[model samples]
Target: MSRTDEHRRLAVLAGIDIDNPELRAKLDEVSARTAARLGQPVSLVSMVLDGAQFFAGSFGLQGWLAELNGTPIEWSFCVNAVQSRTPYVVTDARIDALYAANPLVHVDGLHRYAGVPIVVDGEVLGAHCVLGYEPGEFSRSDLEELRRGADEIVALLASHRLPRAAPLPP
Candidate 1:
């Protein structure tokens, strides 16, 4: 599909408003499990939108970011995972040219990241990710854990999604 078509589809899916207590609870559980499994400081179920990336589920966040539950897309590594349609890993964003200047590296002191795309029905919607304050390698096993967490997140979203209406007869 074209980029425009993809964006439209994303808008429609996101417009259903996946924000709810039950979904959040389940997502938080997934995030916690991912963080523990990977030994990371934080985990997030991050959905990339047109303007911002919303944290559908998260753990180990503090301060204003935790309260806000999201940030502008410019600050998101999860966007890369969605765009690549595969796992995206950064050993150290502070040293990587592509991410060296990103505010999250400088301001938040977040260096390491591993993300797996959350895909459903052939469309990549977002990413499930783990973050760290220090630079380090993420093993293949780490990525695999993230993939499992991503799958769980997708299942939770599918269950909570609003059913689409059928098309009219021609």
Candidate 2:
């Protein structure tokens, strides 16, 4: 299928959120589908601000996500995409000058990464990223599909603000 077609399919899938439970289910389904379609091991939807990373959705790979939260901005590929406000594809992180030493790349053995920046109202919010153990190349179509998913995530976050928990009794 064409990239635009794939993106449209995801957009339709994302449009089904009625509440938190539904949203979470759609996110999981989209992430899994994206991974399956792209033949990748890991697919992630993350929101990266100045100093924090939040995993809105993810598939494949556990345990390491906790480490990603509150991680330094400089160590993340998603941060790079957010800063640049563009798609960043690393075919071989071990060979890239900027990411060769990054813990996610070197220590974790993530050789391939493709990230599309999530921009909402002209401001970058975060990114949708996919990774693989072995090196891989991303096509323009793949990037566009990722971008569509990121846009949907931004919209969802905007529409449904997470409620703040009440304080404990004094």
Looking at model 2, the pairs that clash are none
Model 2 clash tally?
0
Worst 10 residues of 1 by lDDT: 8-17
Best by lDDT: 1
- lDDT of all predictions, in order shown? 0.87, 0.72
- Give the number of the best model, judged by TM-score: 1
Q: lDDT per residue, candidate 2, 63-161, as tens digits? A: 665455335667777877876777889999999999899887777788999998776555565678888999979998888778777777777656755
How well is each residue in 119-141 modelled by candidate 1, as lDDT tens digits?
87677888999999999999998
Candidate 1 wrong stretches, greater than 4 Å: 15-17, 166-170
Q: What is the TM-score of each candidate against the true structure?
A: 0.91, 0.74
Model 1 TM-score relative to the real fold: 0.91
Model 2, stretches more than 4 Å misplaced? Answer: 1-22, 66-70, 162-170
